[model samples]
Target: MRVTVIGAGAVGGALAALLDRAGHEVSVTARGDHAVALTESGLTLDGGFGAHRAGVAVVARVPADTRLVIVATKANDTAAALAGVDVPSGCPVMVLQNGLGGDELVRSVLPGSPVGVGLALFAASLVGPGRVTVTAAAPLVIGGDARSVAVALPVLRAALPERVDVSADIRGAQWTKLVINQVNALPAITGLSVQQTVADDRLRRVLGAAMAETVAVGAALGVSWQAIGPVDAAALRPLQAPGAEGVAAGEELARMLARGMGDVPNPASMLQSIRRGRVTEVDQINGAVAAAGRAAGVATPVSDAIIALVHEVERTAAFVTPADAATRVSTTQD
Candidate 1:
């Protein structure tokens, strides 16, 4: 398979290295110093998968005759990332991004091509130029047209260490992932790792409130949320209720977060973005939830507050600390 992975950041870097190691002809598109490093020394992947390097073609432009195109850019940068690539008509393009609407964007860009959407259920971070650290491992869900799945599944399974499941209802899978990603903004706003943020009772309450709102909005939009990996969206509905059930739901959510964290203290992607002085993806994550809530006539006070605080932090170059953001979020709930 001739694979071109756009956005040679954490997710794309790891995928490129793994696919190259799996004997596929892999090419990665990156920018700046990372592009230079990849072209010069190849890509290095470290962590539980062990250190491995593979020689892959790194380019600023998407090469011709590419069989599989994996769009791994950040949600906000998806448009710019695909703008340069001239995708072959009928080629399968897989969108591996957080939140929603990425698949549609790819479909719009490459009309007549089979577009598959995937939820990357693992944690990976770019440690340095041309290097990525895979801190956690989980199944990657790819869902779309059957033809697209047939084109993507075998090669993706061989390249990734985790299992690959083809979903009949990819939108449901996406909604499930969106629900799980609601906590990502909390870590960015509070300057804490996901584990720390979920472990705090107060913070967990806020997260629970936001996630409940997301579920309500999804319901209003007629999306039947399904389970993504180990996260059962249906089970989380209790968090929306008042009294003891909601408390139990919060505790259950915390326990699930702890289990997901496992032994890896990996920071959420938004937290990493803030640390790098890059704009966070709060708009696509929490902002998406709030937008849906408004359309559904559901109040999303918690999500709205998180969005405002994250934007403020980004605008002021993180003048607000995590503790201060948490205080603001709490006050909003009141």
Candidate 2:
């Protein structure tokens, strides 16, 4: 497969490198120092996917006869990145990005090209100028035209540890991921590491409130969420083992989460974004939920507050470090 990956940052570099190693002709569209580095040193992918360097054609221009174009840029950069890129009319373009509206944006850019959206459950980052770090290994849930899967799936899975699942109801899956991802912004805002944020009872309560608001909004908008207590409990299920058993255990854990008993850690993506001084996708995450709430006539005060705090941080151009977390919390409270 001839694949071109735009945005040679964390996600793009990681995917492009792995696909290149898999015998696919991979090209990464990056700029400036990153492009130069990728051309010279290849891409260093570390962490769960292991440490390896794979050679890929790094170029500024999109190549002709490209089989697939994967857009892994940030949500804000999607429009600018795809502008003027020449893809075949029927060629598949996969959007591997966070938040909603990414597929629509890609469709608008490519017009006749088949556009698919992927919600990546794993965590990855550009730790250096030419290196990508995979913090967690999770599946990439993709929903789009079936024809697009040919190149997208093989290339993506080759790079990732888990296989990609083509979804029938991608929107539902995206919303499910979004509801869970509401906690990601916590690490950025509170200046806490992944484990530290989830360990705090107060932070977990805050996140639980936000998740409840998103679930409510989803319900109001006619999004049917599966009964997600026991069936969905796999990794977090064993956390509360011992005396409880089977369905009873699942129900009990579900009850605890619903009532804000269990704690959860922040996601690495949001933390990395804030730490690197890049804008957080709070507007597209929690802000999207709040917008849905309004359209569905559901009130989402918790989400609204979360969005507001994140927005303020963005507007002020400030970085919330771990040492300043207490001061920020105190100021926001009063």
Candidate 3:
């Protein structure tokens, strides 16, 4: 398969490397310093998995021969990154992003091609120019079937260590992922890893409340989203101790929280946005919840507060300490 990946940051870099190693012709679209680095030196993969270098074509613009186009750019860069890409009339584009709007945005931009939503369970970071670190092993959930499963699945399965589940309901899966993402903000404030934040008894309370709020909105919007990964509250409780009786019941939460933080040196995506002076995905994540809350007549004061705080950090371009964030999140329920 010939694959054109638009964003060569963490998600795009990892996907390009994996696909290239799987014997597909992978061309990455990058610009300026990142493109120069990839041209001079191949991409670097580091973390729990042993690092391997694979040869891939680097280009400043998308060519005419792209078969499957994967848009893995940040939520904010979706429009501009897509503006340059030239896709065939029938080529399928999968949006692997962090929030709720990828499918619609792509459809609005490129109406002819089939657009699908992808839920990335794995954790990856662009450690440096032309380098990506795989922090945790999580499945990449895909929706839509315009492309052949026999052709694309084999390539995806061979490249990624995590299993790929082709979902009939991609929106539901995204909502489920969003339910888990509510805690992403918490880790930034608490200064803890994903597992550590879930393991802490007090932090677990804060996260649980946040997720419950998201779930309320999800239910109202007719989207079914249950937290599936170890990121869920049920998975976090056992890591604390059996005595933590108030948390949800689940066996995998403990094991998930027990796993070592893979290779995430940078903060989670939302936290990174706050640090980078970019607008966080609050509008898509918690803000989406708040919007749904309004339609469904559900009160989402907690989500509203988190959205405001993160937006303030986005506008100010100052490092909002995790402790301060934790204090804000902790007080929301009261």
lDDT of all predictions: 0.81, 0.68, 0.69
Judged by whole-model lDDT over C-alpha atoms, candidate 2 comes out at: 0.68
> Can you write out model 3's per-residue Cα lDDT over 126-203, one digit (the tens) per residue?
767788888876778787655634345666788887788787766777777877677676544444566666666655
Worst 10 residues of 1 by lDDT: 317-326
- Tens digits of lDDT, candidate 2, 1-334: 7889988777777777777767888888887777788889888887767778888888666788788888998877787787766666778989887777888988877788888877776666777778987766556777777767666777777766677777777777777777657657767676665556555655554555555556667767877442222223242334233222322333333344333412333245666666667777787788889788899998767676666666666667564544344344434534
Best by TM-score: 1
Residue 248 shift from truth in candidate 2, angstroms: 17
lDDT of 1 by residue, 1-334 (tens): 7999998798888888889889999888888888899999999998755678978898666777788889998888888888867777788888899987778888888888888887888888888888999988778999887777888899999988889888888988888888788878877777787887777777777777677667777878888777788777657677657644665575577669667767777788888888878888899888888888888897888789989988877777654555676678778877
Q: Tell me the RMSD of model 2 versus the true structure.
A: 6.0
| Native-to-model Cα distance after best TM-score fit, residue 154 in candidate 1, in Å | 0.5
Shift of residue 38 alpha carbon in model 3, Å? 1.3
TM-score for all models, in order of appearance: 0.94, 0.82, 0.84
Worst 10 residues of 2 by lDDT: 226-235
